[model samples]
Target: MTNRSEAGWNFDNSYAWLPKTFYSSLNPTPVSKPKLIIFNEKLAESLGLNGRNLQSEEGTEIFAGNRLPDGAVPLAQAYAGHQFGHFAMLGDGRAILLGEQITPDGKRVDIQLKGSGRTPYSRGGDGRAALGPMLREYIISESMQALGIPTTRSLAVVTTGEDIIRETLLPGAVLTRTASSHLRVATFQYAANWGTDEDVRTLADYTINRHYPDIEENENRYLSLLEEVIKRQASLIAKWQLVGFIHGVMNTDNMAISGETIDYGPCAFMDTYDPATVFSSIDRQGRYAYGNQPYIGGWNLARFAETLLPLLHEDEKKAIGIAEDALAGYNEQFQSYWLAGMRAKLGLLNEEKEDETLIADLFKMMHAYQADYTNTFRALTFEDYEDTALFGSKEFTQWHEQWQARRGKQEKSNELSHQVMQSSNPAVIPRNHRVEEALKAAVEEGDFSVMEKLLQVLAKPFAHTPDQEEYCELPEPSKTPYRTFCGT
Candidate 1:
């Protein structure tokens, strides 16, 4: 075991310095046994941590909540969120933030332990996480980062050597998570409900200094914060759509104010293109479906904007007006980002009015043909269009002709255009079926090989490695209409 002092955790926790009412100061419950499963070496290096010490048994104990590192101040953050459009009081039921670490580059990032144990917010339930879900998040979050999407990252996974009761008894595990800050819209919601207006303003100011520091100089910094968050959500959702990714749950608490994809539960990438496709078993109404993500994103932003009304202006009516003006821009902003992203995916360097119609037509054709989303776009990069059979329709044939004509209008050469499309459209994604297989191997067979291989392929999503070509295949018919669980 390495000495605790040698672990080198440079803790500078700003959130802990906030009002005590904002969070509950508590150490993570020590588990009976702790075993290291995997450690993100690159992420460790980025945090200025020595990989050797972190991989040691003593480090596994720290990660598993069995021991606290030097200067660590563990706490569970308090928050309330709207679940399925209904407001509810909620908080960190099973997660603990082990303070923020100041990286070598002067960035402050939160180091948290999920599935650590119960907190004041546990609310009569066992505050523990299952092994499969922890691994699921580990796989998906890394894949999202590799795909160039801003997201919370997993640092390590540690088995707790205990059983947690969900649908059935499952192996317990703790996930070490890293993020700029875990503060969400629900954090503000909690402040508005439990604390005074002054508390809300304090949180807003703190958030600005942490996330949108550039806007701190503005007189209307809170309003500017709202606008910046809106822009990030808009761009983030656009990127999700382009990649056929669906965040099964877009609850207020799950939406990070840092503009990163925070929660990975029930999230899955589409196997076949369908605007109405939904992966979450809990999302029965399709509220967070592929097509509805943009709308839900806008809706979540509206909820966030409402929390900032107190800081927007003194007069309630004036504040409402200011928020409305900012909220109204979401649609236009989302459209702009979505349109530009779609154009890039199609390798259209020069924008024309017809580009929108062309993109819409392509989606309609994809829906009509039940084509695989990622592969369909990837196939366009081929000069000969060899995978025309994948589309299997005269409609796509006609659309291909139109796309060719549009390509001819681009300023760049065909080679450069192909490069642009290839860069935008990934040759691989963390496919739903493949992810399931990997999880099953890890949870059922105790085999990490499959999960490791999948991660390796996802690490280079844009590259079409010959050995990993099987990953590009769409799921078989039996796997269609796959349902994902929240894994809570």
Candidate 2:
């Protein structure tokens, strides 16, 4: 076997230096057989890794957990989270953080092995992952990154020469995930609930250095960290809404403190514009519906703030006051971000008092007609004569006229406005049916051609490629009411 040390993984894991209770040290369980499925060439280059080596057999064994790279320190991080408002202690059940690799650009990023094996936190369940879910994360996370949203990235996928039992017997797989850091709000909650005040303070300081370095010198660094996290989440959720994404599970554990979209289980984008749309089968109450994401974000931030109350101030009453003030600003911050995104989607370069009403009116028309969310915005870039047929109704005609009048008030020319709208609205998304079709081919038929084509098309989501026009079409009626699962 080739030495992974020669593979150029410059591991420098700072998190491992923290208290032993923060995580459990362990190596990944060896798999029966290791086979490389996919390798992200571009991401590998960015990390200063040799692409050729990663595609070799040695890389397959390392990625599949049969071997460890030199300088690697594997551990399962400990955390506690509020899953759907109920707090519980949880940790890395099926994933192992190999270590942080310092890139050529001097950026430290975590490299994790998802579905490597059972850990101390497995909770009486097998820690193996099915091939379908591993591929699902690969497709969705890469799509999110291409859409210009902050998200955890998929580095590689390796097949295990064994079967895992899910709802039925399925092929096993492992995913190599890359991120700035895997720390979440639950990390703090875990420390607060189990460790002393010094432990919480230490974590806060470490997080501030890693994520919010600008606030490190501030007297109220803890409060500043809270606000910074809240702001990032506000902007992140706005991006999700603009793109019609439903996170399915917005649990506190799933919310990343870095503001990037992390877990992709049961997540989907809307084909039609419905504010109350939900895709996750487990989301029975619609608490995490499309329109409720902003609220859920605020709720999760509040939980994070609660963990920092001790560090916010020495006086309990004063600490509570500081946290409350920060929490109270979440809605206004969210609204500011959401409104700005809506303005861009509507092609309004200069905002006016009536912009909100104008945007709301268009959404109302779309809801009334059950319009395809993506297509409706994309069609606006075409000439009225060519696009009017897409929306044939007196109400739509009136709305169109009002929109034109509003556009006339802009300082920029009509062509420039159209350009802005085209950039803001994507011509295609990973439609639920298309994603399922690709997954089915890969899982049942061992055909990866469909998945490859879908990935290529999603890479340039804003462009309207002639050959990929069919991918932009909405799903048929038979595919309506689609429900996604967590794939556990």
Candidate 3:
């Protein structure tokens, strides 16, 4: 067995120093036959794990939770969340955060193991994961990062060589997930509900120091933290909308306080420009549809603010007023950010008063004609309308003329506007059908070339390439709509 020193794991876990009630220290349930499937060599190097020993059998054992590394402290964090609008206590069910890895850049990041094993928070369910969902997360999260979105990253996936029964028996796998921090809004909710005022205060200080350190010196650091969090979330959700990403589930627990995207379960991008689009098999009511994301962002922030009531003010009524007043700015902040992003996507360098109406009109036409969201923006970027059905409509023709006149008003030439649009809009997305195709090839046939191609293309989302053309094709129309499962 390879010793811990050779693996290059520079762990300095601060979360483990927290009160025992914050998390339960434990070891992963050992797997029988752990084997490496794929390891992220680039990410490993960034985390200072750039050693020759990582891709070997001993490294697979570390990722599979069959062996422990030096200074590794495994634990499952405790918290509560509102799932689908109902309050419930929850925690890490099938995941264990190994420790905080101090990277070469002097940054602390969580190195976690998903599908590690059962913890105290398992709640009657088997703590395991299927190979397909792990790969799906690996692909999608990396795609998000490439698109300049803040997100958790996947480091490796190792097969357990065991069965994980989800609707049926399937192969089990473990994913090594890295993130800035795993602290969620639900963590505050958990602290407020179960711990004392001192606990909430301590957590707030820790959060401010770790994430919003600029505000730590301010007298009203807690309120500043709230506002900063709201701002980051405003920008994050706008980016998601601009790209047509449907998070599918927006529970408070899934909302990362570090301003990075977490929990890629049941998430998918839009194939068609419909505000009512939902892809999660469990979302029967469409509570988390494409259009509802902005509102849900506000709702979740309000919940987070509520958790800060104890720290926001001494009196309850005063605290409620303060939270409401701060929340009042959320919609305006979101609108400003979204409108700015939309302007960039449309290649509008300078904002005009009519820009909002112009953008709305284009969306209306897109929805009316059922235009593909990503392709529509890409079409505008390249002025490519030969085979596009949206361009055939007279309404679109008039809108196109209006857009040209609007473009004519810009100070810069059309070349610069084209550049802006090209940079803002992606040439390819992880199309639903293509993702499924890759997943099936890897999981069922053990053919990884399909996924490799998809990952390579997704790693550079803006630049157009010949291989991107095949992935740009829409999914075949089917009687039943495409659906994604949590696969927990």
lDDT (CA) per prediction: 0.90, 0.88, 0.91
Model 1, stretches more than 4 Å misplaced?
Answer: 1-3, 383-392
TM-scores for all candidates: the values are: 0.98, 0.97, 0.98
lDDT per residue for candidate 2 within 1-488, as digits (tens), equals: 23556678898999999999899999999899888888889999999888898788888988999888778899999999998789998899999999999999999999999999999998876888888889999999999998899999999999999999987999999999999899998999999999989999999988988888999899899999999999999999989998999999999889898889998899999987999999999999999999999999988998899899999999999999999999899899889988988877778888788888888888888887788888888787554334323467887778778877888888998778878887888888899989999999998998989999999999999887796689977667873589998877
lDDT, model 2: 0.88
Which is superior by lDDT, 1 or 2? 1
Write down the lDDT that model 1 would get: 0.90
lDDT of 3 by residue, 128-158 (tens): 9999999999999999999999999999998
Ranking by lDDT: 3, 1, 2
Q: Give me the candidate number with maximum lDDT.
A: 3
Backbone clashes in model 2, listed as residue pairs: none
Per-candidate count of clashing residue pairs (backbone under 3 Å): 0, 0, 0
Candidate 3's TM-score reads 0.98
Q: List the residue pairs that clash in candidate 3.
A: none
RMSD of 3: 1.1
